[model samples]
Target: MNLNKYPVTELSGNGKLVYGCDYNPEQWSREVWQEDVQLMKQAGVNLVAINIFGWAELESSPGNYSFERLDEILDLLHEHGIGVNLGTGTSSTPAWLTTLHPEILPQSADGVRAWPGGRQAWCSSSPVYREHALRLVEQVSRRYGAHPAVRLWHVSNELGCHNALCYCDVSASAFRGWLRNRYETLDALNAAWGTTFWSQRYSGWDQVLPPRTTISAYNPTQVLDFHRFSSDELLGYYSAEAEILRQHSTVPVTTNFMITAHIRTQDYWSWAPHMDVIANDHYLDHRLEAPTIELAFAADATRGLAQGSPWLLMEHSTSAVNWQPRNIAKAPGEMIRNSLAHLARGADGLCFFQWRASVQGSEKFHSAMLPHAGTDSRVWKEVVELGGILERLTEVGGSTVTAEAALVFSWEAWWAYDRESHPSSDIAYLDQVHAAYKALWEAGITVDIVAPGADLSAYKLAVVPGLYLVRDSDAAALADYVAGGGHALVTFFSGIVDENEKVRTGGYPGAYRELLGIRTEEFLPLAPGDTPPLDNGTAASLWSEALRLEGAEAMVSFTGGHLAGTAAVTRNRHGAGTAWYLGTALEPAALRETLTQAAAGAGITVASTPEGLETVVRSNGDRSYVFLINHSHEEHKHAIQGQELVVGEEVADVVVVPAGAVRVVRTSTPAHPTNGLPTGSKDVESD
Candidate 1:
């Protein structure tokens, strides 16, 4: 099966990096709209996403719609040579709809109905809400479907961003209906949810409800199923609107996905297939110790969700976002670097939250292309500069980031891995996945974040981190991948539970024990702040497991703790390849060393990267573009030679990448030297 098939090249007419922001003409007057379009043209903006939250403006009352203002704005933008990514205006319903159908409002787990103060307050499973939302979408699509300015159909702003999970009665009924479709009978449902425990078995579907607020903890399986149902419910809503849009529009349809590993609301892996063009709204978690790395991780995951195809960066901050506590503004030139970073990954289009800063409302303080400081500000200058840079790099569109290394990331595993009764409460699924990804990223190796069922034939190494929930088919796929000469690194806590969150019988790491050639007898979860020594002089913390090797050779053993002398890491030769199992979490340095050693065994070359520098290569079969981003405070010299695409200058010998700046080099020759290192590179990887 060819998994990497879909590719969405251009939503706009031109094959250039789309440069625009969310244009909310309703928020401004007619005169300001003209000025906004003039300024947009000055900045070389080509596409603007409009009508994201215009439901209240479009529909003032039930069955009463108005489009006079919107029509004028669209015509003005079209006259200015700007394309429109038209939003369906269903992200938030009007107040009148909620007033008439109070049940459309979502309720909390404690049964308190959400008020109409914020957006996305409508229950996704409410048939009333769906009907009204679809009605609005149908009206909007028919109005602007074939308009000259319409380039893409943005279904809703960010589906399920605020209300991914709802415990209202409407949602409960929908959950019961979804469960019936999945299990068919009450007995099967009971078995899947393990309802026999605590005498919670249901006699009929009506007896089951969403895992609501109870005196005690709810059933884990029940909560897990609800999570699935809630994601699907939102997906169904999106699909309904998209279907209506397709009935009237011929443009590509999409909804901006909040594709963050931290947000466990909707599984984007399932949602990607429904989108005509994959679009993502990413915001950096400024709280992380390494925020840039997290941004890169999110970008890679977004590209992977698009099946390595070009995607749209639908929304990002121009400077400080109002939502964060501190709301730190971007440093000088940081905006361009950040935008280029996303472009380096796979984003063909670049857009911000809004074209102009809001004068009022919840996001008033949020930065935009035109901030409150006006066009004379540094933000405006940078936005214009980025537009010029994007115009010169039009060839970057439709390019892809290829990788020989793959990391298996599953939302199902993430949902089940972080249960309350886990061996270690501190074992965060995304943290572990990011740890492995960061190690590889810092090594200057590009990694693809793939699903469990993705074809592994193209990758040289596959890394599975903390895969707690393993389906039978996924396990078999991994085993087959390794048996067919693919290297795999399976970490601790993997293959322990099946799809139903049930512990696999017989042994720890159950389904993989035979293929991994190791049997984990017990889990040795360490105390907080405790770091035990490993045989390699590295420390292990968070978790450790007692493993007895069947055919695997012990690579690292515990030097202390209760499981002393046990294999903390092992390697087994299966068929024509090898599978390494780490029974414990190692320190970052130790993990890097282990990964480097395994990668070397597979003959995969690791690029020697400098500190605070990220290197990514995008290829289009004929040309390769090397993007080197210096995320440090000091200037760094790189021995990369090529035509710098951003500046249109030929760099033959060494290039000085200023601190917090980006350099894009277009070259026909390979970026790395024959020895897997750039010319005159200082850093070297030693085994």
Candidate 2:
């Protein structure tokens, strides 16, 4: 977890926070560009991302390049003292190149070619696409690597957004090569993939294929490896382009990672070290029951990628997003609340997808800094107000977010646990993690979403929920953390499989059965819509395990479920700390209470504040910035003595925060207090 504290220092030039958006000069006329920059000055925007999807304009035809338009755009932006986060312009394939060579197109598992009408239509493993994309990348990096306006080199627009897995012949060959490197021989590969199960053993490496659309349910390990291969393939593409950019530039390189819930293509934990500055694109997912909770979880996970260092909020929306089934417009002042929430959780820079709304295209209806209604819009006013807020947060650029608890997050587990065959598909990895995180968030506990193998010594409490697939070493790390005076909460359906998705044969939850002092005989997965009652007056849900406690005490037991008297939750004393096991999914409210108790038992100071008023802190050496966001409709008052940065007022005691508003209190108090910490203080750093 060793990381540089804000490696991209240039982003905040002369101690000004970054407030900008993706600028598509290619989308507008020359006259409009001047107005846009002038408006940018008025809006306090200091940076703009350009050329993200500029492939068609950068290279109009094969062997014929034109940079005259881009040269003018960069010169104009620099004249206005606006820096650029330059993109390589290879995200979308040029129609000319794809038309000339259709082999570069990505194919579906059922042998369907995704055409060039959409962005990211190229296959990741195609040498032909790599040649053209790299050629374009080489040109862009060489031209702008030393350009004064270029502050960061964006490799591509969301590297694995669309073309993560292409089940084409080229992808098949690439997957075989990747497996060869991983397993080294056919025998090891067969053993790892467990090909002995369905008479699917492969004699030669040539027999291997991308787990293509199979008849029924495919081998789990094969699917898992292909998921690994697909992510690595896209990562390999990013690495190739980044290597070229590094040869030409000293500027920090990164791409906007899709850390939101919907996109799970790339494993960002593996991709984090490669980024000089961790940047993520997160949008409010309205489809969920609670998008706000998911937003907090996503930001925490992104910070974890940086190992709790400050990260960049690369992209978010100012209003309604066009992509969702129901594009819900943000209420007035809601945008401000969202941006402040990200800042409260470690984002140094706040940027959006585009500067202006599109007049035509698939994303025309998507929200932007300047929407279709132009300067008179509510979104435009909010964007200006947000820019002002960021300008006041100059001291928070490199300061880290505070966390006392840690949640183990894994992409491998996410890939494997959501496969076709599983007990209770209703219970998902995201659901369980979100449930735990929401609980912690409700308890006023800021948590770090860490990788399974990361050192957990810094946290007082560690939560491992629904991590179905974990490496043996990582499972041991959890046990070690618990044994070394760290409280652990391991939930149902976890520790059931190894890295290869192989079951631990002796009993369920093979990895941590000994440490938990429990042995499960069989799984008791409840049918959908069944919420059986627990003896503790709460309810057990989605899953349960028929188990016998060897050396643990039953904290809760089932009363109405199939296993009436079985232990639903157990607590065991390992060494210097305690290990808690949840055999069944508890109801959401009950889950929060249990998690809050675990947090309290670990000696974490659970806040007594009301649920809707979210409090988080960021600190430098001696100064602390307290951020308060009122999610509820009622106005709230907090006892804090400091100068409010947003409203530019001094508070003697109580700070009044209006409904649907955000407040940042600037004080000289140390955010991370070692001893005699005040009640309701969640400012202590995880380090």
Index of the highest-TM-score prediction:
2
Candidate 1, clashing residue pairs?
none
Candidate 1 off by > 4 Å: 1-9, 670-687
Candidate 1 whole-model C-alpha lDDT, 0 to 1: 0.84
Give the CA lDDT, 0 to 100, for residue 363 in model 2: 95
- Candidate 2: Cα lDDT at 294: 89
lDDT of 2 at 36: 96
The true-structure Cα RMSD of candidate 2 reads: 2.6
Regions of candidate 2 where Cα sits further than 4 Å from its true position: 1-9, 672-687
lDDT of each: 0.84, 0.86
Candidate 2 lDDT over 214-297, as tens digits, reads 789988999899989998888888889989999998888888899888888789888898888899999999999889988989
Worst 10 residues of 1 by lDDT: 678-687
